[model samples]
Target: MPDKYEAELPDEVHELLAAADKDREIRLTRAATAENLKFLELVRSKVKDVPLFWAVTLLSHPELGQAASSTSDKEVFKYLTDVELVQDAHDPREYEIVFHFKENPYFTNTELRKKYSLPNGTKPAPADGTITDEMRAFEAIDLEPSSMTIEWKADNDLIAKHPRKLNSEDDEIIDGDIGSFFHFFTEKSDIMSLGGTIIDVLAEPLEFFANDPSGFDSDFDEEDEEDEGSIDLGDDDDEDEPQRKKQKKERCCHP
Candidate 1:
């Protein structure tokens, strides 16, 4: 039945349909990209007011926090001020993930980034040697795996803090204790496995922030909680009182 339909449709008709589909996809991508930029700007503006906003967001997600299960990983994460995704000015398919950190005992650098791109800036042909216009879309290909180096402070290398087991034969170190979230900076993450979850979380961080149950609100007084407006982290109304922390719930965005 599929072959019969293909035979009935002229090659020109197929070409026209493919062109229309590509145009529609480009339009949708552009619209989504614009909205994402706006959302990110909003997050940047409001996130500082909410202390540990990004840390709580990551920990609340079971899949995302899997790498930060260790105590040191959590501690280092406390300094993570922001996470920004920057698109390549030239190649729409390429982008970088930049992590902004405040002055901390962990590292000296203020920012760490990881760039992702497809080989030759294009997806490879399938086994059948056919590449559809759909395949040419930026969203269609998985980014090649990449890694970045973290300038760890003396004795502050969290990835090395955890002990690793060695093979008995050649005495080579086997994969171990690399689950530290710090490894996210030092190691090559299989972004393909991560899929769109990372992007989704960054694009809509507030939704994830709302899901952090163990948020940084324990310092707030019970009376402050009574007044919803009193829970502003940025407000300096009560200089002596502890600022009321925002509410958070548990939510996951595993790929």
Candidate 2:
């Protein structure tokens, strides 16, 4: 946005972006269990008129968040992105996901496990443990973006073997987001802040997660160009116009 549309956009938009990037959230609009998805869609469409940057509190769509919170190893994305998998500092044996970029850091490891097994192989009480990984993760992070942070002190392997819990749902989402996130920054000339200390994460090669490591679908570019003009935002009137249904109407933010 800064490179392509900045000059053309009004100064008001610029200020909006600046304020938005500074804003933060710990959760999305959290409703009852049944209304979880309903509230999520509410926020996504609510910000339609607002600039994308102005979307300060929306963390995930109901679909993504709900799906992410599940405990199964479902496919989170169609592919993966390059990343540096590290161990959380407080729990150096557990996990951490640090984007390869110097400035960008993704979610931490302890956040991904749904229900970790205690040393005695017992699920801790809610009061004793935190909701993590799979479906619980979605409910926690997506529902409460304002309460969460990308950085975590972490629970060590003695706390739980996070890597062994491999659900792949967060894996997919995290990897894809890493790719998409850096794709935006890489387009720009540069940014500041260097944080490579995460290299001490596992000392092994980064975790591999590309379903199509061979890039078999790379040739679909022709299809992408062909479908470009065929697509239109108006294609989904129901999604754009909330009033069409009784339903309804939303990021954590940063520089």
Candidate 3:
């Protein structure tokens, strides 16, 4: 919106617009989840190599691939069949990330999932409403932190296999090596902050795959010429009349 138009709109209207946008976002998240699930089915049936495709897709992306710090970490990724972010239909903030895995020597479990539920404040209501202060206070309390345990096979724990090699002088990990990617599951303090990184990749895997290792598209041509020519039709007095009528009708119908 233009600054002038924003200044003209009342605060109540802005609040209503924000609420509408949040509702629309929930709908969009559900739609995307359905489409992604459908694509997963297609991938299971049609894709010749599910494990390899997933491994490469993750390793290809520069940011996401950082999770796999070692060759062993990359090797474990080959067992992954599918990874997806499933958002709650009613609550957009509440979601889970699931990784479907084939039976492998690395882990006993087939699926590893991390669920999250960030609180959203209570809805505003009339003064006479039944909502109470105690209810609001209960809702405001911070929920328990989310965590996932990766059941690694004996002698196959990735985090243990690849310990952080520290610098001799400062006792800090050389080159900021955070050990194996499996540490993501072990993070107890700030899983939400760490989950954001994985969530980003799950949200749009295709976009990350398209950019690949260095966030560059080889097929793109930046030098392509754009047509600058424009044809101007002579002004007509009736041009604004139709738009005005449309606006008037919308206001009449909505109001």
Candidate 4:
């Protein structure tokens, strides 16, 4: 037997070390536990619909508590995968995610990592980048419409008082129709002043008047001309006389 002590010690130590190394490898492969999966899933679900820039902002930077608090690690992973945020790489553990700013789409790896605040351990590698003229033009344009219409109505008294002049205070008066003096008084109030009475009556729902389409249509046709002529019943008597006479003559001759 040639050095039996040396042979035994060397074989035993080597075998033991080999077993430990195998166990360590197994543990490293299983590092992403169920808890990690759950967290990633939650983060993914929350940020899936959010913009890519926002998603990256939340996931890459742990300092933004607002983004981190709302999501879990599982959700983050899921969103990353779903959005194809991570690209294929030689190392399965590593990922490549790209962010594009349309106007200046070209970005270096260092710039992107710095701007996005990537994790300390993460390694970013830039591919190709381009900024099309179409993209630049779209970014420069304001897409919102210049004007919009809102349905509204004016108080009859206000309309009556400023018959000749458009209502300065409420330029958005889309409709102005109140019934005759008797109807206004009987249904609305005993206010003798035409302006005040008309306003009060007009404030009430026109359900009764609106219910009969034929009657409403006929009245609308008759009053449409009056409205077009800018004749307000509450206007000064002297100023309204000529307009009233002209309207009367038109009704008699035209009818």
Query: Of the candidates shown, which would achieve the greatest TM-score relative to the real structure?
Result: 1
Candidates in order: C-alpha RMSD to true structure:
9.5, 21.6, 18.2, 32.9
- Identify the candidate with maximal lDDT: 1
Per-model clash counts, in order, read 5, 23, 0, 14
Please tell me which model should have the higher TM-score, number 3 or number 4. Answer: 3
The positional error of residue 223 in candidate 1, measured at the CA in angstroms, is: 14
lDDT of 2 by residue, 172-204 (tens): 233222111222122111111111111211121
Please give the ranking of all candidate structures by lDDT, highest first, separated by commas.
1, 3, 4, 2
Model 3 is weakest, by summed lDDT over 10 consecutive residues, at 246-255
Q: Candidate 3's C-alpha lDDT?
A: 0.51
User: Model 3 — TM-score against the truth?
Assistant: 0.56
- Which clashing pairs does model 3 show? none
Model 2 — TM-score against the truth? 0.16
- Can you tell me which runs of candidate 4 are displaced by over 4 Å? 1-11, 31-38, 49-255
Name every residue pair that clashes in candidate 1. 211-249, 211-250, 212-248, 212-249, 213-249
Q: What value does the lDDT take at residue 127 in candidate 4?
A: 35
Work out the TM-score per prediction.
Answer: 0.64, 0.16, 0.56, 0.20
**Candidate 1 stretches greater than 4 Å from native:** 1-19, 88-91, 121-142, 163-178, 188-196, 213-255
Q: Write the per-residue lDDT of candidate 3 for residues 1-255, one digit (tens) a residue.
A: 665643466899997786666555445654665665566556446544432555555555444455463556756776787776665433334456677789998888788776655545644332453333332333212433355777889998877776566556544557655676666565432321445556555544555444433322232121222321111111223221101001111000000
Ranking by TM-score: 1, 3, 4, 2
lDDT of 4 by residue, 43-108 (tens): 446645533323332222212211122212212222222322231221112222222222211111
